[model samples]
Target: MKRAGPWLRVVAGSASFALPTILGIVILNFLFLQLLPGDAVDVLAMRSGSATVESISALRVQTGLDQPLSGQLAAYLSRLAHFDLGVSTQYHLPVADIIAARLPDTLLLVGGALGLAVVLGLLLGSVMASLAGRWIDRMLSGLLMLIYSTPGFWIGLMMILLFSVKLGLFPSAGSATIGTRLSGLAALYDKAAHLIMPMTALSLFYTAVYARLVRATMIDVLRQDFILAARAKGLHPVTLIRRHAIRNALIPVVTVAGIHLGNLLGGAVVVETVFGWPGMGRLAFDALLSRDFPVLLGVLLLSSILVVAVNALADVLLGWLDPRILTE
Candidate 1:
């Protein structure tokens, strides 16, 4: 049989990084739970009815809340080994089920927002690069900065105020209206309308970063010797850029784009909350307020995995861009 290959090495590296993150997160979370000046037991008892100290003690035991840090961590790892993330103490539901229910909406919101940002940003960036230091470039650069500095929630709020409240253009909040009549396409339309504000807020923030990066890269490429040589050979500007500049310039952007995925995911938190979009961010917000341990752990784990995956994808892309880039 052939020896285990580079794929195994990749898996091992990913696992090595992920394990420490998991340990650190679990420890910090445990400490926070312990140090927080609140009585979860009393809260649970009050909420569940038939309030009693004994019942609260029993509930604490069930949640492993009575255990020491080491013991609780062992139990957490033991359950994690079998892919059991446990139940949410607050919700009386399986943590995985709750995450599964919410993940698609979260993915949809982030994916749509990112897709729009990258496409528009790249196009506008190319235009700005072509225009160089002209008025068009200056105007776009200023606009991009303004968009970048604006907080996503604030932008979302302004959009809602203008588009939903003043102009009556889009739905103010939620994924869809509760009682609005709808057929197949009409239902899709309503959902899209609901997505408009949050998506726009997200896209606008990311666009400036992308545009600036692309413009700088193109400018750098324009100064290269090969580009000048191609121009001297009487090549069309389009042909010179397409044949030499864009190909080389894009390699760096690929890595940058992959790294930006993490930023996009982080930004989704505020955007989701602002628009009342049903996503992991909203779930995480609620979990934090309720101190729902299981759900919180699951979200942290999932987000860490995604961030790592994007970085690994970037490494793979670097290899694609230039085969000389090597890692074991």
Candidate 2:
């Protein structure tokens, strides 16, 4: 019970900090979106073939664009207080509804990419650490460096060219095969096929980073006094690494993963756009091009929340892994 008290305090402190930060982000996002030139009315007017000045003015009035910025902001805040994300100016649908439709796709893509990167990273990093300063380690290091240096979008394009265009093994773009309906395992298989290229592209660079981080950290951990003492006790090499080196080395990796959770989510924007996936990233791209403030704001708010939640989770995990953090 005494040990749990510190954990509770840490959680409480994190929540208290996160709530105000999220509110600030919400306000800033709204203001920045408003500052962008052109409003929904102007976009509508441009799209309409024969929109007259009077028609545009009437549209502005209808959409409440004629209202002062303060009034619009007040109305927006009120709606937000009611858990309303407002209507999308471009789609004419509720912002929440639009997000609900696309959120799962983005989650799937990001989650899959992160999982793949972590798994591959830990495995390769362990191997590299075990072979430190050997030819295998040097070669693997070079390969990882190359992957780290390459841009994710370029990797995606190259993968698409090789796997989709040249060999026709996986889909080049999209979440599912168009005009084809499948259910059960078949449906899952098709989705996985579509996921391959984008997921690979998204995961590769992060995997390289994690591998390098883990390798370096593990090597450092292996040199620690505890590790040396354990070695002097005649502990098996594999058991020593498994029980001690990996555990301590993982702390930094966990921190890195948490810090980069937002980056991974943001990177989905590029990957989704490239693959024509019907996810939040692609939705955001469309919203930006169309100056759809409602959708953009919704995405920003959700993204901020996700990032905060991830960071909070990391904090809790760190506290659990090393109770010393709870004191801090």
Candidate 3:
């Protein structure tokens, strides 16, 4: 319990910082979106093809778009204070309901990708560090560089062509097959099969980055005085690497992963589109095209909260990994 003090303080600090940051993000997202030329009314008008002046005015008033910017902002803030995300102008459903339906898919994709990247990266990096200057290291280094340089969407497409089109091993698109109601393990397996390509595609770039970072950090850690001391104590090579070198090396990796959380979410926009996964990214894309401000703002707000929460968890993990961090 005594040792948990630092972690507790870290959590407290993160919460304090996160609240203001999220509020600021919400305001900025609202204001920035307002700068866009059209709103839901204009898009609805265009779609209807015969919208009249009076009808448009009525629609605006109904949607509260007739309110001044300040009034709209105030209303938005008030809604937020009550935890209301408002109704989607296009879908006419509560924005929260729509987001709740989609959020799980996005979380699954992002979480799976991040998990795969970290595990593969740590293994590959450890191997590279252990086999430094060998042909295997050189080969993997080149491959990592290639993967790092290539665009993720192209990788996803190629994967679809090979794994989905040619081999027919995995489904190319969609979160799950429609027109089928598979329950229990069958449903789980189906979802996993659908997820493989998107997860791999979303993860490859980050894997390459994390692998290279780990390789560098591990090599540096192996040369540190503490590592030398561990070696002098006649520790097993694997134990020394695992308990000393790799553990210390993970500090930077964790820090970078926390920072990359946002980028991972951003990348999901493209990956989700390519794979046709029904996630928040796809929803946001649709909302953008349809000028569904309520839905878009809700997505953005929720995404911001998720990023902040993940970052805070990362900080807590960091504190646990290195007690020195707590002291600092």
Candidate 4:
């Protein structure tokens, strides 16, 4: 209980800090969306065959867009205080409802990709570190560099072309089949099939990054005095690597992974579009194209929260991994 007190304080501090940051993000997102050239009314006018100036003006007033910027910001902040994300001008539905409908697919995609990246990267990195300067290391280093340099969307498209178009082994785009209702394992299988291509595309670059990071950290840790001391104690090779080198090396990897969470989510925009996956990224894309400020703002707000939460989780993990961090 005594030890738990400090952790509780840390969590409380993190949440307190995050609240203001989230507010700032909301304000900034709102302002930026306002700065964009057109609004929902303009889009509506363009779409309507006989939309007059009066109709556009009336629509703006009805949508509360006629309010002053300060008033709009105030109202938005008030809505936020009450956890209301507002109604989407494009879909005419609550932003929260739209996001809730799409969030799960995103979670599944990003979560699966992250898990695969971590496992593959750790294993590959360990192998590379163990065989540093060898032919295999050089080959893998080159390959991963190539993968890391390539664009995720391009990879996604190519995968779709090869696997979906040519080989016909997997679905090219989407989270699941359109209409078929399958129960039990059949449904799971269908989802997995749809998931494979997008997950691979999303994970590829991250896998390379983690692999490189882990390899470098492991190599550095292996050269440390403590590692050398452990080696001199006649510890078995695998045990020394596992208990000393990998453990210490994992700290930086965890930090990088957490920091890159936002990037992964951002990249999902392209991957989701390329694969037609109906996730938050795709929703955000559509919202942007339609100038659905409410939906866009909601997505931005949720994304910011997710990033903050991940970073906080990373900090907690760091403190747990290295207790000295807690004191700091």
Clashing pairs in 4: none
- Local distance difference test values of all predictions, in order: 0.78, 0.89, 0.93, 0.90
Q: Write the per-residue lDDT of candidate 4 for residues 1-328, one digit (tens) a residue.
A: 9888778877988899998998888888899888889988898888887999898999999889999999999999899889999999988999999999999999899888988898888889988998999999999999999999998988988898899999999998788899999989999999999999999999999999989988999999889898889889899878987877777777887888888888889999999999999999999988888888889999999999999998889888888878877776
Clashes of each: 0, 0, 0, 0
lDDT string for model 2 (1-328, tens) is: 9878998998898899999999999998888888889988888878887899899889888777899988988888898999999899898999999999999888889889988998888888988998899999999999999999998899888888898899999988889999999999999999999998898899998999999988998888888999899999999989988888877767877788888878998899999988888899889889998988889999999999988888888888888777788887
For candidate 3, the per-residue lDDT at 186 reads 99
Per-candidate alpha-carbon RMSD to the true structure: 3.4, 1.4, 1.1, 1.4
In order of appearance, the predictions have TM-scores of 0.86, 0.96, 0.97, 0.96
lDDT of 3 by residue, 1-328 (tens): 8887777889999999999999999999999999999999999999999999999999999999999999999999999999999999999999999999999999999999998998888889999998899999999999999999999999999999999999999999999999999999999999999999999999999999999999999999888898889899899889988887777778878888888878888899999999999999999999999999999999999889989998898898788778888998
Q: Candidate 2 at 81: error in angstroms?
A: 0.5
Using lDDT as the measure, name the better of candidate 3 and candidate 4. 3
lDDT of 1 by residue, 1-328 (tens): 1334444555567678767876786667656765655545656776678877787788788788899878988888788889998998778899999999988877778778877877677677778887899999999999999998888889999999999999999988888889888979988998899987888898887778777877888888888887888889899887776676665656766777777777777788888888888888888877776777788888877776776776776666666566555443
Candidate 1 accuracy as lDDT: 0.78
Can you give the lDDT of residue 126 in candidate 2?
87
lDDT (C-alpha) at residue 105 in model 2: 86
lDDT: which candidate is best?
Answer: 3
Point to the candidate with the largest TM-score. Answer: 3
Displacement of residue 311 (Cα, Å) in model 3 is: 0.9
